[model samples]
Target: MSLRCALQLGIPDVINSHGKPMTLSELVAALPVHPTKTHHLYRLMRLLVHLGFFAMQKVADNHFQEGYLLTPASLLLLQDNPSISRPFVDLVLDPILIETNNCMSTWFQNDDPNPFVTVFGEPIWEHASHEASVNHLINRTKASDSSLIGRAVLVKCKGVFQGLNSLVDVAGGTGNMAKAIVDAFPDLKCTVLDLPHVVADLQGSKNLNFLGGDMFKAVPPADAILLKWTLHDWPDEECAKILKNCKEAITRNGKQQGGKVIIIDMVMGNQTWDSDDDKITEAQLLFDMEMMVCGIGKERNEKEWAKLFFDAGFSNYKINPVLGPRALIEVYP
Candidate 1:
């Protein structure tokens, strides 16, 4: 939550705008905190710095010997960043979700489908579908994540879209991923399929459009199907169903050469990081628990993913560990 506090206070933005290390007093003056709370800012900064969100740096300013500077991880917290993850942070740290998480023990002792169902009286999807506010938060969270992860995929795996003539981003919230893809591949027609409420008011352009549908029932036919962070939101059976729909979508035209399903989601125990292995592992673990508590899904390893693909009637698959802590998997039919 300290990270959320920093984002709330616009600390990263302040430090980044300074262009140089910002002294403690400068940060105090720039922030909106009251005079009495100025002293507490130091404690917050200390914790944030220790957590690697910021670094203590020697500044030339005479007001203080050291100042705070934004770290690489903190850059994503900047409000103006195109790939800002603040929305995800806000969604997870929201008070309602926090309260739901607190009911984890109660959920364990009961027959709830998940902790969210335990507290909210229904699954997250039901509540989000009925509650406009919750639905907006979920969409915003997915959009924020897609912007960040999509940038990496475009950079590292642009080839994944090269041969495809048409693509469907199943559950592509708000079309952020589709927007990026369409911009990168203008000739490649792109469609964003999401819940009706999620895409109801969204607009599209020449190469991009939106469709409201359920992945469990059917996915729009396309040369390639994109499932970025979609399947991990469901259990094995549901994932199998989604993949089956995707298989049918890709093979609908009977053009077998370039039809494939491109997935961008976390693959458990698949990191080959030269450093920060522990940090990546911790993030994957935390996200796995988040899935378990928030939904019925769990992160899958290569073996599990392969089993799901084969069971769904896919011929073969490939995993590219290009996205840190996540992977870009190509499953072919």
Candidate 2:
């Protein structure tokens, strides 16, 4: 939660605006913190520095005159950064989500879908739909992460969108991913398909539009369907249903010949490890557990993913393990 506290205190932005490494006394003066808590701030910074969020840099030629500087990881957390992931950090550390862990033992002995359901009496999405603040937080979190992931996809897998004349982003929140794709591929028409409540107020341009609908029922017909980190939020049955809908959408309108579905999600044990650090494996495993606690989804291995694809009527597929812990999968009908 120290990261969240740093975000809450706008520490990253403060250091960034300083234009140089910030001294301890300067940070204390710039912050709203009480003078008596200056040493506490020091302790927090020490921990953060050790954790690699920030670094201690020498202000002058003396080792004793060191100042705090934002590290590469913390640079992306700045408030004004387009690829900022602060909202995601906020979502994971939210009180309601954190409390779900305490109910996991109860959940295991019950018939609940997840611990969040065990505590709140409904699935997270169902609860979020009824709670405006919660819904906003969830959407903001998705949008923030999408901003980063979308850029990465464009950088690493630009060929995926090369020949596509039209595409649809399933469950895309606030059109962050679609917007980036549309900006990169100006001639390609991109549509964002989401719930009615989520897209009701969003505006679209000539090449980019928003459609409110359910992926389980139908997806808008397009040359390609993009599912970025969306399938991991659903169970196998639900994922199959969604993929079938995507298949039908792509096959409709006589576009079956070259249509495909592009999925960006975790493929368990698919990442290549250079050493014994195994940070990617650790993240994927932790995310799987987080899904089990927050929802009914779980990370899938290649075999499990293949079964889902074949069951959904997909004829061929390819997995590109280039996105760190996640993989970009191309499914063809």
Candidate 3:
């Protein structure tokens, strides 16, 4: 929670604005905190400095004061980065999610859809819809993730969007992913299809537009379909249905060439040459558990993914393990 505290206190922005190492006294004075919390703030800074979020500099005895400075890791946490995950951090650490963790054991013993339902008497999405803060958290978290992945797709993997005349981002909340894609590929016609509540009142650019609809019912036709961090929030059966629907959309949209559906989600237990890190494995497993806790979906290994693709009537597929734990899957009809 130290990272959250740092963000809540706006420490990174403050230090960046300071333009120099900010001493404890100077920081405490600048913060919008009570005078009694000055020493407490120092302790917090000391911990974050050790955690690599900030750097420590010891000043000369008489000339200046010893202070803290921003680190590269902390810079990403700034509100300015296109992929800033501050809202994501806030969503994960929110009281609702934290409390859900406490009900897992009981959840396994009971027949609740998820631990969240056990605690709040409804599914995560249902509760989110009723609570403004929860709704904002979910949308903001997805937008931040889209910003990061969209950037990576543009810089590291431009070939995916190459030669595509039109693209549709299924469940593209607030059109961040669609905007990012259309911005990079000026000639491509981009459409964002999401629920009305999420996409309502959102403006679109010349090449980007929003469509209010349900993915389960149907997805709009396009040369390529983008599903960023989308399918992981569903069970295998539902995912198969979604994939089948996407296949139909692609066939209907690009009848001559038969377009592909691009998915960005975790391919659990991925151990390619470059991604053999134990930490990544642990994180993948942790995410699977989180999925279980939410009663939505679980991460899939390559074998499980292949099974889903084949079941959904896919003829060919390719996995691009470029985005760390997450993989960009191209499934064709």
Stretch of 10 with least lDDT, candidate 1:
271-280
Candidate order, TM-score descending: 2, 1, 3
In model 1, the runs with Cα more than 4 Å from the true position are 61-64, 273-275
Residues 218-332, candidate 3, lDDT per residue (tens digit)? 9888888888887888999999989988888889885535689999888887764454567678878988898888768888999999999999998889999888778899888
Best by TM-score: 2
Q: What is the lDDT of every predicted structure here?
A: 0.90, 0.92, 0.85
Worst 10 residues of 2 by lDDT: 269-278
TM-score of every candidate: 0.97, 0.97, 0.93
Residue pairs with clashing backbones, model 1: none
Give RMSD (Å) of candidate 2 vs. truth.
1.2
In candidate 1, what are the lDDT values of residues 111-171, reduced to their tens digit? Answer: 8889998888988888988899999899988998889888888999998889778999999
Error of 3 at 113 (Å): 1.6
Residue 319 lDDT in model 1?
Answer: 96
Could you list the CA RMSD of all candidates, in the order they appear?
1.4, 1.2, 2.1
